[model samples]
Target: MTRSTWRTRIGFILAAVGSAVGIGNIWRFPWLTAENGGAAFLTVYLLLVVGVGVPGLIGEFVIGRRSNRNPVGAFDELAGRWFRPLGAVALLASTVILSFYSVVGGWILRYTAASTTGAYFTAPQEYFAAIDYGLGAVGFHVLFLAMTVAIVYLGVERGIEVSTTVMVPGIVLLFGALAVWASTLPGAGGGYDFYLSLDVAYLRENLFSVLPAAAGQALFTLSVGAGTMLTYSSYLGEDRSLAADGTLIAVLNTAIGVLAGLVIFPLLFSLGVSPGQGGPGALFVSLAGAFAELPYSRLVGVVFFGVVLLAALSSAISILEVLVAYLVDEHGLSRERATLGTGGLFLVTGSIAALSPAVFALLADTLANVVLTAGLLGFLLFDGWVLGRLAREEYARGAGPIARLFELPWYYAIAVVLPVFLAFTLVTGVGGILGIGISTRGAAAVAVLGVGGAILALRRHGVPG
Candidate 1:
């Protein structure tokens, strides 16, 4: 079977942006920002996105476009069987993310439909509590998974590229309109102050506490740590600047995320609702109540959730495509068989997540961040050590002079600095999740030791640097 490639450059960009601009941005970003000192969190997150996220993104892109293979095959072919497990880690990260991600997608789907009839307007909190877990959640998850499978079944160009080309623009345009309208709401200025006004003293005092959450959100929002970007880039047939494309995707995703905050914060503030109240349920519970009280309640609710649905679907498609591409490339399955098989697997996993709140929280809140961070750590290590100069060569390919200037610095950052930072974040993330106390020095020691051991192991395996 012949491999599929993106039909156009813009198609590729839109699809990549679609993958990045998803539930992570629309739902989770605001919730996280609110929970982690608002503007203080945003400040750390933006710095990390530029410093760590972009280089990490290009690492995946270089591996993907250079090999033109799924994550597994790319590693297997590029490095050796020794590195195949690294790729498998990325594949697992994708499966883990979309399992819970589909459940959230299902929620968005349900909310979008219910918004049409003002179903949740009467009692938003109670409605969410009732439907958050159970057979209804499972059914909706299946429905959302089915929609994703249909698109992947249609092949890359006709389905993902075409759909995201429309969806990305729609998300941006609709979000722009919502933001504009949100600015007009009375007391909306408070929302702007809370979100946009940085508290330097708070950040200085709480930088360590804020780093893990900000780093995780940065990875999550950029779609970097998972193989989603790698899988998407594997469909590229052209020689273009990976740095430029990766930067653009990150910028677009960040812009949309900030725009979502613009829409969400003001609406929450205007309604006298605290943004940080419900944790993961904040977006639905808080926003649903706000929509109900607003003029044209049903219309507002539908549009908001509908945009969320589109974002969710776009991201779910990229994640599902990772598995589909793996099956087709590595197992020699047809696209249709690969997609259906992947969908079947997710149906079981997503249903489990939906039916069990503990399972959902485990996947969404804890495991997703840890796995994505670890997965990107592996990619950067492989890029810096195993791929070495080949990685640099691939990065510089088709890059413009401006992009070329940063190639050496980018290489060192991905190879050394970013890996150390990711390892530290990963340690902090795991310790936080498991209720363990890890001092910053302890975490740094662990990160250095971990990276050093990996390097020695690669050298022992006769891997070239």
Candidate 2:
């Protein structure tokens, strides 16, 4: 039996965008901005999106489209046996990500239900604190993971393509509508200024602190370097241009991220909910509070959490796909077995995160960044070093003359600059996570030289993808 592919280009792009634009954008984006100097973080994030995210997006596609295999096989097929370790690492990273991601998805689903039931009417934050702990969140996490397993086990055509096509448009429409509605609220202007204004001094002082975050968001938001992109691209039929598809996905994801900020900040500001202080609960508690105090409040709560549920589900599907593909490819497990096995693992791991705020905070912040950045470093190395020649050729295939011109720059960036940047980010992000933010200068020194050492090691091996 042949692997199923997307029936249309629109389906492909929408599915990619669906995975890219999710809880990461809504819940995480606003929070990260609040943590890392609001507007300053946004500026650097935008810069990295174009620089790091887009190329990494193309690189994943090249590997996937070229081999027409799942992520593990794709690298092994092109970059030889040595590259398989990196492929395995990407596979593991996705599984780790999904374990936590699905729990968050569950939180969204519960909030959506609560919104409909008017649960946020009295003490929104307190309500969140009560429900978002221990057995409650664990139960919800299991349910969310089960839903993800069911859809992904159905395979790409019915599972990913159809689901994303429907949900992606719905999410976009809902957020846009929410933004318009939020704009009418009293304090919406303050929210807009806070979110969109440029802060040059803040940017200069905290560029390094924010760099890893923006890069991680770019990577996480795009679902790039996670092997999900590679898995999705593996189904490509070559009738579509890889460059064009990647660009559309990146643009849509970025647009949605900005759109989410527009919707969230306005609502929170309008309610006098200091977005800076809200943490992960802010999007839920803050917005729920806003709805409670506003006219026709119940309707807005339904709309907001409904949008989040859709976004969360879409992204969860991508996360589930990673483990599913890896199991089916590497271990020769059936889709059903793989999803079950993966879900079973997450059941325990996610419970830990659910029960402990410390762990969840770590996963959501520094730890997630470290793992993802490290994984991307491994991925870019596999592409640039191990799969170097084949990546160039694959990137050129079905590419327009205009996009083809970017091949060398893409190569150098992924091959040289990105790995160093990733290394710096890995250390710096870890440092901050460990309460060592003041040591960024020392971290920067290591990031510079260590990444170079990685490139030299690759050169010594003469890896050729």
**Estimated TM-score for each candidate:** 0.97, 0.95
The C-alpha stretches of model 1 lying farther than 4 A from their native spots are none
Q: Which candidate is the best by lDDT?
A: 1
Ten contiguous residues with the weakest lDDT in model 1: 456-465
Residue 426 alpha-carbon offset, candidate 2, angstroms = 2.0
Task: List runs of model 2 lying over 4 Å from the truth.
Answer: 294-296, 434-445, 462-465
lDDT of 2 by residue, 102-179 (tens): 778888878877877788787887888788768889888888888887888788888888888899898888888878
C-alpha lDDT values of all predictions: 0.89, 0.81
Return the number of clashes found in candidate 1: 0
- The per-prediction tally of clashing pairs is 0, 4
Ten contiguous residues minimizing lDDT sum, candidate 2? 456-465
Give lDDT: candidate 2, residue 145.
Answer: 80
